[model samples]
Target chain A: MLKIKVKLVDGKISKKEMVLNKKEVTVQDILDILEINRETVLIRKKNELITEEEILDNGDEIEILRVISGG
Target chain B: MDKSPKCSRCGKKAIIDIRYREEKLCRRCFLKFFEKRVHRNIEKNKMIKPGDRVAVALSGGKDSTLTLYILKEMLNKVKCELFAVTVDEGIKGYRDKAIEFAKRNTKELDLTHIIVSFKEIFGYTLNEIVEKNKVLRGARGPCTFCGVFRRRALNILSRELKASKVATGHNLDDESQTYLMNFFRGDIESSLKMNCDESISELFVKRIKPLSTTPEREIAAYALVKGIPFHMDECPYAQEGMRNVVRVHMNKIESTFAGSRENFYYFMNEIIKHLKTKEKMKFKLSSCILCGEPSSKEICKVCELLKIIRG
Candidate 1:
């Protein structure tokens, strides 16, 4: 099992720990697991900003931020 | 990646790492930096004057919400008053929620909030327009109708509110995308002449973009950090294919090249400045025959689109 910490920046969710059955997961997979819209949020891991294709490792701390686009 | 980086200003744990500048910033420092940059943009451009009533084109999105919040803080030092004008395009699920957020934000800030709807002004909601145009003319996508009408609505509302300047939340990304989109479409003239300076037409409000220099990501982060409530829902008709392609390409380039976005922005500004000096690009404005608003063409885009919808 992989232990990862996820923090939601939009105040929708509190910082929590997610135990994953896989050792690695893509950012989209995490969004799917959390039921967050892909286009609505950006993912960041540690000090680096991440894209949907970025892979996460065990014990990683990820931050999901809601993005606003021009109307 | 450095798991823990110190803020460049102070040794506090940094919340964000700005790779473009090779600096890390904590939440407090980041907010300070953001506000300072916004103030600099406004001051350098002379966007607002003392005793000027500035109307913020608030859409209840993160960018517009942050624009209103920062402008309110910055304008407090001056004698200007801030008001929010929200346009309800009559988007069923999306706009309804956003207007609610806009109302809440404006009420909390103690600013006068005005809501204008397409149904009241144009005699048809966006949905109705789309529905009618689909059968009549297979109307150009919803964005085409929405953008033209929304702009006119904002201008009219600003005038009615007696606002001297209208501020929008367009950030660096939006501007850059638009610039590139026009470039790609071979419509360099539109990009060059687009909002380079305030309009002389009395019907058009002097528009300002306080967040023009800020990136959309930074605006989003600031909105979240400041606890500003904004609806994150995107418009259902926002799938403008070419613009989206340009946006993604620009984001990819910016990610790889760091300051590429700002470089493009500055490059475009220089070109616009050079063009402005080379020739006087002026349009003789005429009142729209139908609505009596300022228009370069005889009928104006709003009247033209309305004709299509009503027919």
Candidate 2:
């Protein structure tokens, strides 16, 4: 199991910890597991921006920054 | 088997794969690609020119911050005077934090920053207006009020400052969503003004969106990569807007259909060319009797909203 800390950096700053059973998980997989829209956010790990296909390691501290401003 | 894509330009580890452009770019190459695209958009659209005084609508968000930073880079090439205008709608915790970010960016760039508030202009903060408006059920969402007032506030200040253009941080996602929303709502007539290079009215300043061709996620990524400080905190009242519904759907459509957003924009842009030539499509612009601001009706939306809030 992989221990991942997901941070949502938007109007409300909140964190969700996920313990995944998969041996390999991409950022897209994390977004899928978290049910986050890939179009509306940029994912980051270790303060570096990452792409959707970037694989996640155990104990990854991931930040999701919402890019949507309004309607 | 390493499935990771490398930079198509330099063969370095790619930070992003722009599927729409069929290019995988590293951090260094991506920045160049982004700025070059933005510069090209501004030039192709004739959004800016030498000796132009531009007022940037800086909300301290990722989009606006990227717009400001990019325009700041154009000081030499474009030879334009730039200033930042931030609308403080008085959302307490939310807007206050954003204003600090706005101030910091302007200070760092040595640019003028002006903050206009709902309290000062309308005698009631957005929070206060929402509180008072609670008496009437389904009166309106905070966005309706904020959008009308903020646009008015930005317009009034930009014109007063003698700016040639008001540069907003509206990225491709926003424009594409708007294009789709208007289409879905059958409000094509309202968007007819979009293709007009001419100022609709002297009272209404020309608005330029250099980032309108760029996607929102890419802007956020650029900001993050460049270490640009921005307050990405969502406005608490944001979810109440109708655009929230469309944005979700638009994002879904774009993700499923890569390049769909840009295609929508281009299609809409071309459609407007044919539509604008129709006699029935033209709307005459006139000044609001009460405030002497440009309006199609006797009263502008700002004054009308103020009347309701004041009452």
- The Cα local distance difference test for each model comes to 0.80, 0.85
Interface RMSD of each: 6.9, 2.8
Q: How close is candidate 1 to the true structure, as a TM-score?
A: 0.85
lDDT tens per residue, model 2, A1-71: 99889998766679989898889888889888777778778777777777888887788898987776432
Q: Distance (Å) between predicted and true CA of B16, model 2?
A: 1.7
Q: Which stretches of candidate 2 lie over 4 Å from their true place?
A: A1-5, A69-71, B1-4
Q: How many residue pairs clash in each candidate at the backbone level?
A: 0, 1
TM-score of each: 0.85, 0.93
Tens-place lDDT digits, model 1, residues B140-236: 8888888889999999999999999989999988888888888878876677556657475777788899998998878877776677888886678
| Candidate 1, superposed: residue stretches over 4 Å from native | A5-63, A66-71, B1-3, B137-139
